[model samples]
Target: MDYKDYYKVMGVERSATQDEIKRAYRKLARKYHPDVNKEAGSEAKFKELGEAYEVLKDPEKRAAYDQLGSNWRAGQDFQPPPDWGAGFEQRGGMPGNEADFSDFFEALFARSAGGARRAGAGQGGPGAQGMHLRGQDHHAQILIDLEDAYRGATRTLNLRMPEVDAQGHVVTRERTLRVQIPKGVRAGQHIRLAGQGAPGLGEGGAGDLYLEIGFNPHGLYRVEGRDVFIDLPLAPWEAALGAEVNVPTPDGKVALKIPPATGSGRRLRLKGRGIPGATPGDLYVVAQVALPPADTEAARSAYRRLQEDFSSFNPRAALYQGAQS
Candidate 1:
């Protein structure tokens, strides 16, 4: 997807305040509005303007967009960073028609749009007359360690929440919360904390705070759902014969058996050893042969003797046979 520099689209500077952004968007929008211009591509320009304004006008969305950094240029190929929205707390729902927006807008705010629809459907309109209006639900992404998924953990998190100050400038407020992470909570799963969102109006109850789970980059493991994978480095002798090697997992280290003549890229599975769950995922140990260097005279001599012992074995015989065919 191509990156849309919202500031560039609205002809505003990166350091422009909320008021400056509003004025810039208004001027450009008037020039591009289809009803006024009636020129070719005017509608497209107007839609683009709306999309840009949609993000800039809101303190929450603007704060999130700014986190994407300033190195990106307009129209450049773009993909959001893995932890792009992590630690940001924003109220649910987006105003305006979502269909009129570009994929770039949807990519970032689709979750908020969906939350808006769900909230409206379940709780009725917050503006209904004589109704006790519930507060808006909030959403955020929080990162946890892989070990936390194996065993439940408690974490203290600091979240940045954007709001408009009395001067109409966007400002960020820091909020801290102590949260409990349940075992087997996979990435993309949400943990909901009741009464932690925006305050209610009148006699209604406060809305919920939903935290989406994400795993921190693990040093030794990769996770897929509940499954875990780790590279098991084996010496040349261990690969040629069999050996019992210590493998580190989220739970702890365990001795894994290597079969005779194991090759690099072979995967050995340990059942029910991944994230804790009723139907737990398996841990996969991928074999990687670590060859010893022949820098020393003794090592060179050993390699020469081994090469002579395997002189009849042609490892590339299949490649040569394929070429002939």
Candidate 2:
């Protein structure tokens, strides 16, 4: 969707308060209203002003639009991220003349909905008076760790939801809900808690809760797909001659075999040890070779003799062809 700079349209600065926006709109709207001004393109300017005011006047819409930032030029070719504007309801998209806005308004603010015309009925189609369907949709976001996806867990989450009272007033009410954390659920994945949403209108069923997964950064491993990867630091001797090293996993430490001649960045796979699932994922150990400190003359002399003994084994043989005739 194209980004709208309502601030620019209303002729107000980015830092303008709500009162300032209202004042600017009042001044410009009077000059642009076709009925009052009767100038060329007055209608067009009035429509644009109305659109800007419609967005800025509403606190929810204004806050959401402000989060998009001021970097976008007024008319630049724009696109929202895949997840952009997903959670926010497009209030201006309703059907009646109560919101007689254009498609441009709908594109940014709402979605076009059909009235569900069923053929061969006594009535032509379902109208507003027909059957008032659609109980209120419930919205919620739950946070889960990256490891929880691999290993399922149960958690107690504190949920606070804002709801409308019988008189249509906005009120935030709090409640404690214990939710299940299913394995293999990735970040951005939604877990629906059935019938946990707002109560439906009349006799309709309740809405649902959508839980979005999140991960707290792990101390040792970085998760990717079904696999867990960690950098295992090993001594130079362990890398050259192979050794059994203790490595950390989410569960606990385990002895890992480092094969001889294993170079840095060499990966060792522990099959089916990752996040518990019907088909388990593997754990990968990437070798990070560490050298011993050389702070003594004896150590320097021992290294010199070793270098002299195997001096011909220049590892960088492939780098240059002597660069000479």
Candidate 3:
């Protein structure tokens, strides 16, 4: 499929703001309305413009489209990237409106790549007299490990589907299939499994199965884009005396060096060790040095000794700006 330059179609820049894109769309649409222009192909161009704006004016869709990157030139005979839409939120499947676009458009953005195969599906089928309809395509959700997003993995999934019989009675069936979970797939995105949906109507092709992906929340890390954040727990001694602390990451455990006299909330960076493939997103370790709980006599005695050693330290005064307000 030829890549469409949505921005050029709307006369906007790659960084064009939502308002700017919208204004451009409106201006061009008004100028070229076929009802008024009466020019050849004006209607087609106008329809194309509207579709482009519909996707780009909204932040969510625009973001998803942009993440595909500007390396693609409009009108280029292009193939999708090996791992497209990685870290992107996907809109749910909406079947193509045959009345709306060409096959080329359908190929470029087939919201419903797989279709339901139904037997005797029409409102009144000639064979409804004795034929039972095929069941609808089944949808499933798969929650995968975060590492699976960084490095793709395959899973064996068991799917259960319910079908209605001729008399409209519901019966359930289970099917097991092995699915490949592509790396970098984010929440809300789905993988289409061709011919994996329901049985087709009168020998029609089976519908596609869409698999939605979700990341397993890491106990030690929080992910944003490629960057991952972690709260690094530190002993008071480790914070004050400068020590190498063992830190946990999605990849595994590693010794992270902490400079001496580091304060609470201090950030330590581990470059090229975050989510994979994305510049190895940097790991931001926010230090949270902890002291012993003051519930025991031994702990109280230790606190007293530390207070005596640094009695002049006034954390409260510094925190509240000495009651500046």
Candidate 4:
């Protein structure tokens, strides 16, 4: 599956607002509409535009697409992440008068398209034109701590969902469930809970719920895949010379060896210290040197002594040399 960069197709930024996207779509739609322009490939361009707008126009679909990560490049080999749309309700309908779409779009969104068409035709409801349909699967995100991934945890989730009632009118209902988060679950991983979503119409089985895992931003740590990173602040002297420090990890504090002449931005790796799994990721401790405030006479004297000791070293010499060159 080739990745589709809808933002690129629509000539808009990823941060483009809804109005901006609409404006861009309208402009391109007018320019590429086959009826208005008989240029070569105009029909194809117009259909592609419609496909892009079909996804970007809807907020829910746009959000689900965005969660796939912005790191993917246009035309890159793309496989939709597993259960990417698990808890999300699929809304039907395409933006334009097109019936056929690209393989990539169909693979990712065709189920929703079918559901929408059936809904528009009044076929998804119970006894709707004498047709029975299974409930739509629901998708949602759950936030957890990095430590929670290291150790399995049980989480309570509260969700508000809409369903048809006895009178055939849709009603919003709150549902809560206690879910167990398995250990080593990475960000964006899905937890499928069977029969926990919207109720089925008539005798149809209830839909399944999918919970996508997300981690709240940790103040001291940043996670990438399974790896974790922390900025360890050290005194200037401690960084300049060797120092044995105990750094915090998800497991606990561990002794970290700081080599002599270590500078700010130097990263020390602790193997197998990240989220536990078959092959655990390493923990990276980034060094950040801290300087004491020159408020007291003792601090001022210490700084003066250090300045005198390294007076021959010119930190700005490289900048001056570059300027001269």
In model 1, what lDDT does residue 112 have?
46
Rank ordering of all candidates by lDDT, starting from the highest: 1, 4, 3, 2
Error of 4 at 164 (Å): 10
Q: Write the per-residue lDDT of candidate 1 for residues 85-195, one digit (tens) a residue.
A: 789887766665636888888788776424531354224554665666677788888999999999999999999999878777778899999999999999888999998
Q: What lDDT score belongs to each candidate, Candidate 1 first?
A: 0.86, 0.67, 0.67, 0.76
Which residue segments of model 3 deviate by more than 4 Å?
Answer: 1-139, 162-172, 294-296
TM-score of 3: 0.53
TM-score, every prediction: 0.84, 0.57, 0.53, 0.63
Over the full model, what C-alpha lDDT does candidate 1 score relative to the true structure? 0.86
Q: What digit string (tens of lDDT, one per residue) describes model 2 on residues 204-272?
A: 555555655556667788777677899999887899999998988876788899999988899999888
Worst 10 residues of 2 by lDDT: 114-123
lDDT of 4 by residue, 1-325 (tens): 7888999999998877777788999999999998999999999989899888888777667766776878989889988765565434433444443566788887676542322223333225345644545656666656788899999999877654444456433344556789999999998687888876555665766666677677877888999989999999998879988899999998999999899888889999999988888998889999999888999999899999999999998978999999999
Q: In candidate 3, what are the lDDT values of residues 156-197, reduced to their tens digit? A: 876544433454333335577898987666555778887665
Better of 1 and 3 by lDDT: 1
220 Cα displacement, candidate 4 (Å): 1.0
Error of 3 at 237 (Å): 1.9
Q: CA lDDT of 18 in candidate 3?
A: 60
Instruction: Point out where model 1 deviates above 4 Å.
Output: 33-48, 75-78, 94-107, 110-131, 312-325
Of the two candidates 2 and 4, the one with more favorable lDDT, higher being better, is 4
